[model samples]
Target: MEKQDVTANEENDLDDVANSSTGNLVDWDGADDLAKPMNWPNTRKAKNIVVICYLTFLTPLGSTMFAPAIADVMGTFHSWDPLLASFVVSVWVLGYFFGPLFLGPCSELYGRLPVYLICNVLFMAFNIACAVAPNLSALIVFRFLAGTFGGCPITIGAGTFGDLIKPENRGKIIAVWSLGPLMGPILGPIAGGYVGQSIGWRWICWILAIASGVGAVASFICQEETYPAVLLERKVRRLKKETGNENLRTALNVDRKASHVFGRSIIRPLRMLFLSPIVGSLSLYQGFVYGYLYLLFTTFPLVFQNRYHFNTGTIGLTYLGMGVGSLIGLGVGGVVSDRLLTKLSARSGEKKPEYRLPPLIPSCFFLPIGLFWYGWAAQANAHWIVPILGTVCIGIGVNMVMMCVATYLIDAHPSFEASATAASTATRSLIGALVPLAGRSMYEKLGLGWGNSLLGFMALAMCPLPWVFWKYGERIRTSPRFQMKL
Candidate 1:
């Protein structure tokens, strides 16, 4: 009888362990589970995506929109050092570096919407602070705080993509979402340059604060909790309350001390960044690329003002090339990614995460071409349209590559998509924050031709990154950590 009890206890323990993993959780009602976001109506899902994309758009917009106004801010602050002026821009990104380390995991514990709305409110309030700041120091400090709040969407938005869309269809859906971030930064300069040129530098912050207030309203009124685990947990809570059965639970979570769970949740993004090779490799690759994009933001004004003799407002117009390229990339990457998956799945009778990579291959090559072309063309003082053409290519390439990398990470680790994206965002943010400090110096020393050529070489070196993952990604996914336990 003692032996029988031991065996039964072992079985119970096994059951508890199984329950701790995802498959055993209180899942959606099979195919018709209204609770499952995947089953949400196309219109409802569209609304959720639109809000999420708008949220995504706001952060980069806030970061880059001020680029055109950097000189004005510098003059107002009474500084001539470009790097010191850039500190205002770079410091905000520094917040991006840390927010994801914790916020991404927090989204997992809480739901995406609460975290998003709260962060958006904080971001908007800090923008108001920045507008009214008395000194350069105060402005820098407020920008960092605003960035901390604004950083939420970039990290969490990828997880939003994972939540609402399936792997196969995610490409096109993701492309649509990609438009916001890509367009926002380009658009920021276009508007900000004119605003800073005409009205004043401080209004840069005022305008963003007003626009963000609108976004915050849409967020609170329209968005819903999209995290599946969180939704299931809510269902479990409702069932427990309704039936008076305390034992009712979900497979997504085990009954553990809240403290223990919270501790793990807090450290998960860091752990993913440090320990997971999949997350780390892609983070490093994309980080460098993202950093270059920011560096370009700093350089565009100098390049146009010095090389082409364009005024500030018209210099902002040059960014339209990149904006248009991003839209094209969105369509191309989205349609191709979805179609490729559909066709490949049809052939193999199933879909695999590795299939997410083909769209990125073109990006690798296009980036270098744009780099080399823009560098030499601007150096030669070719027609103004020539360098703009090169920028268009870079825009399309970078957008497609980034969207694919994000989708690949999401597909590889669906359970930990938020943490995975956090890892990627963490590196990207850190690199972006640090690299622009050197952008002015690099352009000054190398001139437009060699400076961009150097960047092009970096892009060429990174070309192998997507290919390496595409070839061996399945093997990497086989590691114990990436797999969902049965």
Candidate 2:
């Protein structure tokens, strides 16, 4: 009797311990589980969002801040060939082509935080290399290295948003997030012009390095781990520790081989781009938008200096028109997207990805309008303000459309949002790098009127994209492949 009682007591103790160990379980109890990022406190989510925004801001700021200093760099290096001078910026753009395809996949293998922070460190270090370079070749190599890592933030960022915010509540957050990239082209040159003119071109690189150092430190401290699978894996490890159960596992369990991780990262973006018509079409359109943006960065100086007779300092200020438009895009686009999502969700009795797309419609038509007006006004040498109006319209329309596609994609593929974003980014970055080469020649040969009109016609051809997706997206999404495999 005594032996049996002792065994019974042992069993009861084991049961109690098991009950107490529930907190450490690898799986979330339900959708309401606080461990899930979507259920994290508002304050906690805000911290992540703010840190991510700062990181995103650093990229575009670094890319274009050196623009006004380009001439000075060439003069200092005694570079007689204009193309070689342009190569400094072009090499950095080349990094944009490669970073997304690699880094985006790596984010899935490692957690978002680790991948982002590591890239930030490398990017900053390369900026220092750029600052102290002994020759033009050295500077070009460093700039390329910096850009290769610098693009990690924007590439991996859409996944972080999907991890934190539900589709219904994502619009305002996305708009705020987008402001960094849009405004960078505006603020960067403004600061770069004055600093480059007053101090020297080298200071532009030094200043960016310093700013990135601050960003890296802040990210290390404030940005929490956001990848859902990563969080679940952590829970699995913790549960194993607590329960002394070696078999504890989560759905995230997978091989961690560097080769396998890398191969998938390389191949997945290609698969998504080639296999999914939705991703391909949207990405191609986005490519045009991104390419156009870079073109503006390169071409604007020529336009303002030649047409408006603006000096460097004044030429930089011309970007402010687009800056204001960025703010408007954030405000107007966010409101319209959120309102549409809310209304559509209520009507359908379930929120669908299609809800994220209605706002894209307006932007589609408006872009060509801006392009044509901008072409004609700049062609006729109309008041500088007239061309500026076209810029504002372009800023708002392009960003609104961009915002819609990114958010819609997140909703469309929660499991592979990072990879999907990478695929889209690859197309866009490739165009951004290649198109600027043509932009100057195009404007010179065709003149602003016909050159921009050509771009406008291209924009018009792509306008059907939003409507097709808005109408048929559900059917496309329901295809066996995306729904099942992802």
What digit string (tens of lDDT, one per residue) describes model 2 on residues 343-459?
A: 988998988888888878877777788889888999999999999899888888778877888888777877677677888888887887778878877988899999999999999
Q: Per-residue alpha-carbon lDDT of model 1 for 46-164, expressed as tens digits?
A: 88888878877887888887888788888887888888877777788889888876677677667798898998898889999999999888999999989888888787888877777
The clash count for each model shown is: 1, 0
Could you tell me which 10 consecutive residues in candidate 1 have the lowest summed lDDT?
9-18
Q: In model 1, where do residues sit more than 4 Å from their true spots?
A: 1-26, 254-266, 480-486
RMSD to truth, every model: 7.3, 5.8
Q: Which candidate has the top score in TM-score?
A: 2
Q: How accurate is candidate 2 locally (lDDT)?
A: 0.80
- In the predicted model 2, the residue pairs found to clash are none
Query: Local error of candidate 2 at 316, Å?
Result: 0.7
* Stretches > 4 Å off in candidate 2: 1-25, 253-257, 481-486
